[model samples]
Target: MSVTNQTTVTEFILLGFPGPSSLKLTLFVTFLAVYLLSFMGNTLIMFLILMDSTLQTPMYIFLGNLSFLEIWYTTATVPKLLATCLLETVTIPVSGCIAQYYFFFSLGATECILLAVMAYDRHVAVNRPLHYSVLMSIEICLRFSAGSWTGGFIAPLLPTILISHLNFCGPQKIDHFFCDSDPIFKLSCSDTFLAEALGYTCSSVVILTSFLVTMSSYGKIVVTIIKLSSREARKKTFSTCASHLTVVTIYYGTIIFAYVRPPAKYNFTIGKVISVFYCVVTPLVNPLIYTLRNKDVMKAFQKFLAQKRFLLTRNMHKF
Candidate 1:
């Protein structure tokens, strides 16, 4: 082994979205719209849930947590992406790079688990309506919300630890939009069997477990709803479950494609597109999925806004 062989690693470069000068302007606009909507929509949803006591149920409690996660989730990448568009080039330090991926990984993982928790919440609410108060009390709500965040933190520490054992050689270019595990692992010069194995195992456990739990919960819910509730009530209950199921499918499908498979070399364009689906698109779509389908949330939002306006006017008159 020569010195060149011995010196196997340095730094990695991230290549964000590619386009012409005019296209950067277009990308800038599109990214701005996504960032704004993701922020405003999620914030509004959480605000409504918090202000309206009627929305203080277990389901909306999880929704509020999901909305809060969206804020940090999008913030992890969107601002950097927007800055890259403006500066036309950007370099994140290695330390900053790892930290960025840390929180990004955590939040993404938490969201994956949170969606399943939300599914369970709906199942319990609809299927076991009688025990809803006893089962999903405030304590259980807090525990599940905290559990999702805890799992998020726990899931990625293994990968990061395994990554620490490897050294980087040359080939510093990361061929994707952001610093994801797939591209990061690809850039390493060392044999990546251990790291890759861990990646696949973790993805399977996190996603497959969540999916199984959601499905099992829903299966019980369906039978329970039909037996106990009126036809109209059953229809109303399934509507919310269906909407949640749709969002879960879309979000997890993209995630499975990107992360669940065995790690290998990836094409730049394909990776970028898949990354956008999980990162940019999911944050933008999740809030809409719930708000558009659920009338209870809509009514709660109206009530919250009306109360706020009333208070503001009252304060103004007092002044």
Candidate 2:
């Protein structure tokens, strides 16, 4: 149907995960478990950062913002995905799809910027330990956090607007689990050149810029760590950033592959598989990575548990 004659699509069918009917129950269970784990893990990180006085430093502040972002990040799509797995044929209104894309992109961009900020934080800590307190003060941390969020939210606005205005003439089925750029662009009948260009530009600027910043910071950090005479000093310094580096590797690797490609290179099947890593796995693993690797977080968690137990015991005695 020509764009001139056909009505714009008001809704889209999300062909969520091409799989056998027998796998739906497994997929639902798996996604549900992932969502819950991601939520609780990130929430615990936020809670520890808030309550633990020792974790009130600039590093943990960035971590807290990340955890908070992860909660909403996973929330924006996972629940809907869970619903889709259960319902079989999932249809979304145009507006809802747009909203989902905006939030998902915004949070993702925020994470990129935030991760760079964290790398810089570690740089200051390791290379300029004497000036760490002065360099990464509370005010500066808050400003960086606010700027990351603001830039993230603003970056996607124009592209999202462009995508939403495109006419979907027919075959309004999104072949991916969620409303991603490639799948959405593939479905549109309108001239998507401008939209695709804008999407690529925004994605490259956000991902590449942040990736460079993160790598540069880590590069400097590695040099400084190598300069340290004591092996213990070097090990300790690298430990601080190991988790973040892991997350950065996973996130940038997946996102760059997913978003920065030319339209011709899009493989929807592979795209969905890669999407699961960043979308479902990254958020779920972030808290685990940080906590399992960092002694400070473990100590805080133990302390918090001990305090809760003490209070529980005291209350029981009173009762």
Candidate 3:
């Protein structure tokens, strides 16, 4: 069908998870709670990282950025998802859909780069402990962080632009809850070869390269740990990398499975499940993973609470 002949689609209907009407309330409550938890948890992580001078390190700095990213990530999709649960049909204007698409992919790509950078940070800290500070200096950390953000913003530009220009005619229904590339691309009336090519190319370069870098970094860290003589020393050394490793596994595992594939091969059922994990569940779990596994974060949070209590008591006495 020619672009000119097809009817222009001004808005899209998102066919979110379909279930019995009875389950609507349960679904809405579940997603709403997840969104709030993700928001508060990530906010707390960022706040603690900023206020606590004790956490002023390269690792914590990257974590603060990740926390900030997770907050926006959930915001990009969950609200609309909640709406779909409550409403019969969830409609989104074309411009709004495009905007959501851009921010979601950009943030996701930024996280990929950040995770790789974090892995490299761990690599340096563990393998070259004596020179870690000198190697991963403040200047270096800022440059890498800035580069990740910049790369993320730029990486999706070509693909998103290509996708935006494509014609979306009738039957403007997106299978997924969000305005992801695959679903949007599937709806286009024009030839989507270029968009798909660009998307797949970008996904491969960003995801595969980042995954390899992370794996390589961890491999080196493992090698370095084995060389240590003391059992306690080795255990302690591995502990530092544990939280990051866990997060990396969860993030990359779901994303790679979801995006790194041909559109024709995409199973809607599996894609929806994987999308929920990466989009909803992962963000909520991130703060828990970091806080519970990390003593420093827990201590900092406790101290913050104690200080607030003390201030409240002191102010009450004055009143």
**Best-to-worst lDDT order:** 2, 3, 1
Error of 2 at 214 (Å): 0.2
Per-residue alpha-carbon lDDT of model 2 for 1-319, expressed as tens digits?
2588777789989887867867877998998999899999999999999999999988999999999999999888887788778886889998888899999999999999999999999999888989988999999999999999999999999999999788887879998888988888888888999998998899889999999999999999999998999999989888889999999999999999988777679888998889889989999889999999989999999999999999999999998
Model 1, residue 238: what's the lDDT?
Answer: 76
Model 2 / residue 254 / CA error / Å: 0.6
> TM-score per candidate, in order?
0.89, 0.97, 0.97
Instruction: Tell me how candidate 1 scores on lDDT.
Output: 0.79
RMSD of 3: 1.1
Question: lDDT of all the models against the reference?
Answer: 0.79, 0.91, 0.91
For model 1, which pairs clash? 8-168, 8-169, 9-168, 9-169
**Model 3, residue 161: what's the lDDT?**
91
| TM-score, prediction 1 | 0.89
lDDT of 2: 0.91
Alpha-carbon RMSD, each predicted model:
2.6, 1.2, 1.1
Q: What is the lDDT of candidate 3?
A: 0.91
